[model samples]
Target chain A: MKYAYYPGCSLESSAKEYDLSIRACCQYAGVDLIEVPDWICCGASSAHATSHLLSIALPAKTLVQTEKMGLHQIIAPCIACLTRLKVADMEMEEHGDLKKDVETVLESTYKGSVRVRNILDVFLNDVGLEKIEKTVTTPLTGLKVACYYGCLLTRPPHIAQFDDVENPHSMDDLMRAIGAETVDWSFKTDCCGVSMSLAETDVALELTNKVLEGARDAGADCVAVACPLCQSNLDLRQKAIGNKFGVFYDMPILYFSQLMGLAFGATTTDVGLEKVIVNPFPVLGAI
Target chain B: MRNKLEEAKNIMKVAVKEDTTAFAKEIQRKCGQDVLTCYQCRKCTMGCPMAFRMETKVNELMRAIQLGLRDEVLSADTMWWCVSCETCATRCPQGIEIVEVMDVLRETAIKEDYYIPVESIEAFHKVFLRSVEAYGRLYEMGFAMDLNLMLKDPLKDADLGPVMMAKGKLKLRPHKVKDLKSVKKLFENVRKLEESRV
Candidate 1:
């Protein structure tokens, strides 16, 4: 089970713990993650938001490199990265001039043959639930988690083509495999205003406040997320979000990969759990 | 791009040509999404999570495009506030790629000018792409600092620097891609292509 890995920018910095935990899970899952040699930034939320030419051309370079690496599929753990790469792949196949222009920009042809998959999709579909169930050495039986699937995880249907876009159960199913109770929540595919979090602080904070309030109302002990942006927005900004709203809900925004590591008998430090703003150790400790 | 984006920037600069559908036609030509086909179902606006913060809702903006309200549609803060949550796109009954339309609006805004009262995000993207062009990957600390300076709010997110560095997430130096020169050429080529299109 070897695959190319494009960590993207966030995973490399700010979301370092997410990168660590994901690599740790893949190691135990017996999956080999070959870092695509000199992978370029996929020009995520920025490129697509700014320039169509750059958006397609940027990810085209990454896809070309993945093919050169001889991997038919690549794993991009970040939801934004997954969307950008997948969208670029779709554009490469559907648009003739765009593809040609992209190739001309890079001085390379984009075959558009490479498939982009998120780690969760690989674990649930490729690795199967039974294997995951048996791999859980320390079952998190009592810990309740609200699985946060930010927008674009599986949507604009033709592109992501991953789990059910509206009520994504893929993360819940994975959480169940690790013996954790997945809480049903409304903000499953809600927008956390990730891009706005930096630009318009109040707008982003107020929007994130809704998700935080939703989870807090759902009676979950903590939140489990697949995307780094959600984790940081919900966790990293929890303090400011609370300060602005005059209500503080200390729900830990954990990486689904980190929770998987804990289920596999990994310690807090092993998955870099100490790095998150809202600590999950106390919540996990309660169990 | 000019009609929709430029109208909002400055009425004097935007010339509403004879064809009202010219803006719609330009959008379709640039990107495949069709705004003229929308019949005001409002499904896109209904599912939009950011509607609370948007001045013009998705459906309203779609109608604005259809009516050739170039300046009104282009100057809308709605596109900038969009998180690209795909909910609107996924739920649109007309099969209109609403998110793509927002992306198109943003790019058009850039082409016209970054004077849509959301220059901060524009600054971020510009600096972000510059970082990628320089190193093939985001130079987080450097980019954030540069973005702050560009936005003229240098003290913004100042506390996050040391906190991130403490967690070993913020790197003092950038992880430059091995083939940095080739990566830069891609950006240059794209810019040349963009400027030459019109």
Candidate 2:
């Protein structure tokens, strides 16, 4: 299978591991990822707030680009990008005025012909869990992971429509396919306080701590996520949270794709495992 | 306690003064959902895990926004209360992205120099930017202490002292992030861009 891939900004820098691991996984799965050309930032948490038209236009620009490639489904790995792009598609489809307004701003036409699917949505929905399960060569037995569905994925399920809003099974099903155990916890859909990380550390710390404690309490050895922002909050925020809350939790948070690569018998280097904020060595040692 | 009727009246007065209607209007323009749809359903409050300790009412926040009660809406502690769970955003009948609305309000508050648990939050943001600037990645331990100090809540350190002692995890000596100059340079560039944008 081939996809028009949108890795987003974080994938280029802080979360390069996510970019690498997903690429490795696609290669293993015989999936082709065509990088979107001349793509601009999706405005993430910024553009959407300032200019209404820019929010839709930014993603629509990419959609127009994808249309040029003749690809209908684009595989966006970042949760924020996936949310913004897919939500744009959703809003454009629902509000005709919005489409006209956005088109006027971009001086281009968008027919909403393309669809944005995050990695998890594409893998679990299009590729099939059975295909993933069949490829597990080194069964990641005994690795207990917390499945984290960052706020964007499931909320407004109609736009990000890949899983249940209250209880998502895509990541869990994917984790199981890779031979890992997923904890049954309610915080799976909890917020990582990503946007609030800067202005509201106290709140961000509390929320991040909740997910960590919830995962630990639920007997998860590590937390698994599909979003780089979620991984940043869960893994990178630990030290700051430790200082604010006075608790130390060196929890190893891994991208779901990394674990999948592990289960598929790929080495840590193949997936850029060394790049994560929280070291996965201890966990890898145990495994 | 202040009279509930008088308090509600006063709240309305302040809300109007803040032009919260404009704020809500801006959000509606962006999100395409009527901010007025939030009829104090409290589903957002019910779903908010951290609502137990917050000083503001999530339901009233919506009302403030709809009424264009700008001052009340911006100043109300509810702006700080969001954990960004998106639960309320998810549950809204109008499909409002409540979390995004909160973000917009926060940014607006900052732009207008209104009020925002800013001292604490700004400090934390600075710490994060420092880390990102230095390592091109977030370093938790250093950023955490810096943020705590910024909060001026010295007790944060005192509270952690015992826990750190118990776990043998506290490092008395802080480590400068590797390639500190490069990180400093990065932060300098980011600040320059941010300054230019502002």
Candidate 3:
């Protein structure tokens, strides 16, 4: 199976492990992800927060490329990027003038035909769990994980609709398929304070603290995530959150892709496991 | 805790400061969310994770907009505090797309220069857009530096820089698109569109 890929800004930078593992997982699934050539930024939180037209137009520029590639679906690993692309595509369809405006802005015609999906959607629907189950060489039998969706994965119900808006389980189900024990937790769809991370660091830290505590309380060994923002907030800032709250959580916040890679016969180094901030090796070693 | 009754009285008193639907109509035109259909269930407020940080509750903000309380709504730091998690939008029985409403409010506040956001939120968005306009994708290094300059802090994230660098996570260069001319043109067209809307 072939699909278009938008690595997004974070995937190429801070969230490189996500990119590495997602690519590794897709390769094992026999799914070829062709990068959308000359694809621009998806306009992320910044575009949507400031300019409505810019939000639609910037992502539309990327969607226009997907359209030009004649691909039906584009895999945006970053949930924010996926949402932006999905929002832009939906806006173009919902509002006729907006589509014309985007066309005029980008100086390119967009068919609004690309289905913007996260990598989870690709694995869950396209590649099927049974196939993935059959391919698992290393069953994550002892690994107990809290599947954290964060936000934008199943939110803004009018747009970016993927799974249950409040209680999504695609990630959990995927974890189970790979032989990992999925813990039921309330903070699965909670916000990791998002863009406020850089600005209001404490607030983000507090939210991250809650998620980590919740996962731990619910008997999860580690937290599995889909979005880069969620990973950075929960993983990158764990120690900081610990420092502020005075409660150290050695909990590992791992990308679901990395876990999938681990089960799909890839080495820990190949999936970039050692790159996580909280040192997942300590926890994964016991498994 | 402060008296809820007194706060409600103050909110109402400030809300009547401007009784014009023109602002409401403009919001309807610009944001395109069905805020008028709100029955004040406060589900949005209840679902909002950042509600504690917001001066105006999410549902109250929607109600204020509906009642044309432009000044009260715009000057409030509620929109700035919004994390855009969309839990409010997701759980709203009215299907009001509250996150979109918050976006328009922030955009309006910035454009009209009504209430300057004290937080580094404005600087963050500006730097993010500038990075995209320049490189077609966010350049983390440049974004961090530009953010520092805008926030009047040269070495704010200086410590985290080295940590990120050692991990081999921070890409030194910005992500660039081949058709940068198109990206420039897109920004130009958006500016023109905004001017026309104004």
Candidate 4:
């Protein structure tokens, strides 16, 4: 299957491993990811939080390019990017004035025909669990994973429209297909206090601490996430969380694609596993 | 019980004005979310992850907007702290998208030049958009450097720089899209539109 890929900003930087693993996993799954040329940032949380017009225009420009590429479906690995793009698409479709205004800003018409899919949707729906199961070269037996769906992936259900907003099972089912045990956790779809990691470190730490503590309490070997913000808050800020709370919990925060890459027989380096702050090598070795 | 009834009677004695509907009408026009549909249900506040950090809770913010408490809602730090998790929107019994309401409030605050209670987040938002304006995508090193320099906290998240660099994640150079001029034009158009509205 062929689809357009919008990696967004984080994938090129903070979530490089997600980029690597997603590419590798897609290759194994026999899916073609055609990168949208000259794609701009979706403006993410900052744009909508600041200017309404810019937020719609930024993603509208990219969607215009996606349509130019003749791709009907596009997979955004970052949940935040997916939400931004989907919001733009939804706005353009629902409001003719917005579509006209965005087109004027973009200097191109937004057909709103492109279907935006997160990595989880691409894997679960596009590639299908049965197809992924057959491709699993190394079954992740005995590995208990806490599938953290953070916000934006399935949230504001009407916009995302991906899975059960409260208790999403797409990630869980994807993990199960790779022979990994998905742990039942309460904060699976909770907020990871995004962007606060930069502006409000304490609040971000407190929120991340809760997610980590919840995963640990639920007996998860590590937390698997789809969003770069979620991974960064949970993994990069773990040191700060431990230092502040005077509690140490070295739970590896991994991209769901990395685990899928591992299951598909891709080596650690292939998936950029070394990049993770809290290493999952020990746990992987044990299994 | 007598005191509560007296307070209710006193509140009922005050006349509602056309100005009270101005804020609610503007919000509805901007985001298509009807604040009037919110029936004082605290479900949004209860589900909001940042409610504890907010000066005004989600439900209260909704009520304030419905009541056209422009100054109260605009100056509060609640809208700034919202991460737009959408839990509030998803769980609202009335199907009101509370996140959209927060987005509208933030836009109104910026447009009207309201005194932002949380300046750092506002600063980050400006710096982030500036980076995207320059480069089609976010330049992490440049964005963080600009943010720290603006916030006067140069050493903030300084420790993670080397760690990220070692992992080959932090790029010193930005990946500008091929059509940089078009992106700039888009920004210019947005600026013109925003100015026209003003």
Candidate 2 vs. true structure, TM-score: 0.75
Q: Candidates ranked by lDDT, best first?
A: 4, 1, 3, 2
Q: Specify the highest-TM-score model's number.
A: 4
Interface RMSD of each: 1.3, 9.3, 1.1, 0.9
Off by over 4 Å in 4: B1-13, B17-19
TM-score of chain B of each: 0.85, 0.67, 0.84, 0.91
Judged by lDDT, which candidate is best?
4
Q: Please, what are the lDDT tens digits per residue for candidate 4 over residues B57-111? A: 8888888888888899888889999988889889989999887888888888887
State the lDDT of candidate 4 residue by residue for A1-287, as single tens digits. 88999998999988999999999999999999999987899998799988888999998887888999999989899988998999899888888988898988888787778988777877887788999999998999999999999998888888888889889998999999999999998999988997888877888888889999999999999999998889988998788888999878999999999999999999999999999988789989964
Model 3 residue A34 lDDT score:
95
TM-score of 1: 0.94
**Which candidate number maximizes DockQ?**
4
DockQ of each: 0.59, 0.14, 0.66, 0.78
Off by over 4 Å in 2: B1-32, B35-39, B49-55, B65-71, B74-84, B93-198
Model 1 DockQ class: medium
**Where is model 3 chain B poorest over a 10-residue stretch in terms of lDDT?**
B15-24
Model 1: per-residue lDDT, tens digit, B50-114?
88877888888888898788988889888987888888889888888888888899999878874
Query: In lDDT terms, how accurate is model 2?
Result: 0.72
DockQ, candidate 1, vs. native dimer:
0.59
